[model samples]
Target: MLYISSNLRSLRSKRNLSQLAVSDAMKFGLDQYKKYEYGKNTPPAESLLVISRFYHISIDLLLTVDLEKVSIGDLVTLENNRIVLPITVDCNGNNLVEVVTQKAKAGYAAGGYTDFSFISELDHISLPWLDKNEKHRVFPLDGDSMPPHNDKSSIIGKYIDKLGDVVDGKTYIIITKNNEMVYKRLNRNGKNTFSLTSDNSFYNSYEINFSDIAEIWEYAGSLEREQFKPETNDINNLTMVIKKIERDMVEIKAKMA
Candidate 1:
């Protein structure tokens, strides 16, 4: 409401961060980056946290006030005693896709990239296969557990939530036993154990005591769907390799049970 984006842009300029630099930190390409600063996009709560942390400010500052209008340095203390500073967030979508693909090739996916996907209130997303409606969240599938799904599809697009809001049934992108990344529904059994259920029969469930998870970041919005595509025939080959990797990863996980 306070044109906070203008303040952000001003502070970023003062700090010598070009628009490209900010985009890199946010994992957004130049186009998405421009849209963010221009207020065409609003980041999620997690993203807001990351941005505020980068500026050494509370979320309140970024959400409600503009530091530029008050004749302050990049840093500012609000009436509520919150601090704000200029920060840079940047990333190249194409490069990220390549890196992520390579990670899949290596049979693992690391956690570092933040989710940028979002859903609008007015949007309608329905899945007949799961008998669900109006439940949706854009999740970047990290590995090849769903090779058919990721093939010809960018990892950054919107995914229909067939499992609804039930926390345990919520499908999540998680690390499997053999070190590959995957999307699986999380289930909590009565015994302090959690199950990683995969929809693909080729990949089995990963059941753990729920203590081994390294980190879990919830899904956000869809990446701009049209942004990525593999340029060569290697995509198909990569897909096959990833599918086999995911299968082996799942087998190893099932054995851990």
Candidate 2:
């Protein structure tokens, strides 16, 4: 059975709260609260609710996850309580790549990436090309906006540690504060915005402000659903036709000679 004792102690220590202060805030006897932290007794549901509210954390997390190992930045608010990111680490303490499918894309945009319960419900798989030490996430692509990457393909992205690390002319998966996820070739426009261009000229490029960006993932590699077919424009088609006619004329001339 999972015990909340160690988690409670860790939370208190992280906040540097005194046991007596916590007991006083909960309006419980000091000895009773001490027993709760000592694992000799469990707090009542009401007391647990009060403690959870005070810490701004969910009761489930307080009772299950080891809070000492979780970083503050990794937590996100969900239904009035904070939950840690659902990152799975191997025995060697390496992060595993989590795949975001079409079905899970909407949820991921809704802060599901940091919600342990939501992330745990999604499917996870490992990739051979990715290093275990590097943080990565796979996102499924949907349109021909970025040709060659096409519809139904998936891109493996390495998590960019900072916005300053973004390189120009490289592809990235940009997650916006407005819950839009876009895959585009990025060019830094200024300190506050980026020019996002598409490989397919049919779609026009646009700029997104850095203030609106929630996260940035650098394109590492891609997995095609099938053989890739490059998008062709009018000029490309005309060039192909001209080349074919020239080849035919050369064949006729060789036969005549």
Candidate 3:
């Protein structure tokens, strides 16, 4: 309870809100507000609601120990009397979703050329982001570009944006000049190649042909580990590799159609 009060004060201070201002907005006297913040009394449901409204927070955040506010469907852990909320998909018409993160691509690639047999099976595949009118699939991240943490192989069927034109701020899996697929955050630079960047600092930035891309899918979510291990996982890296190949397959099929 004391912890909650401290958090309230801390949050108010961070947001630059005063208790008196909050109480005035909620129509409460300063003394009553002091009691709530000082742990002298538990806040009433109405007061909680008012605080939630004023702070643009969920009631769960006001009275609970969960400082990281996630969406309704996000995974949450109630441990050590604190809430640990996992970041999750936005249900408010974001039009992206997660799929099976295994076996995104198949067959073999010799040199830089790929056999279409494995790619052929992926054609006409439906993704969670399609949402009836939109046609897209959830592409997963692959290779060392996103490695040292996430395995390229762990996210085979994850989502990526399949919108006609790649928009800024959306993430994508891209194939580089080395014929390697990488899970990169897509930041468009002019009309030529897309800038593929890894979130981790250990990896370097590079460009992709864009034309050689097999497909463009939509991004949805990630499998977050409880702990952040400094070393990257090889299995996860390969999983993303297969996913990028699968995206390339989809791109080829689209060009043919």
- lDDT per residue (tens digit) for residues 128-159 in model 3: 43353332333344444554335433333332
Model 3 segments more than 4 A misplaced? 1-149, 152-164, 175-179, 223-257
**What TM-score does each of the candidates earn?**
0.32, 0.62, 0.35
Candidate that would win on lDDT: 2
Which 10 consecutive residues of model 2 have the lowest summed lDDT? 76-85
lDDT winner between candidates 2 and 3: 2
Put down candidate 1 lDDT per residue, 118-210, tens digits, no spaces: 111112233333212112222345444543445333233222212222277765654333344555667877655667776555556767654
Which structure is stronger by TM-score: 1 or 3?
3
Query: What lDDT score belongs to each candidate, Candidate 1 first?
Result: 0.48, 0.76, 0.49
Error of 1 at 217 (Å): 4.1
Would you give me the overall lDDT of model 1? 0.48
Which model, 1 or 2, shows the larger lDDT? 2
Q: Write the per-residue lDDT of candidate 2 for residues 22-89, one digit (tens) a residue.
A: 88988889999999999999888888778877776666557765667755443333222233334654
Query: What is the TM-score of candidate 2?
Result: 0.62
The per-residue C-alpha lDDT of model 1 at residue 220 equals 31
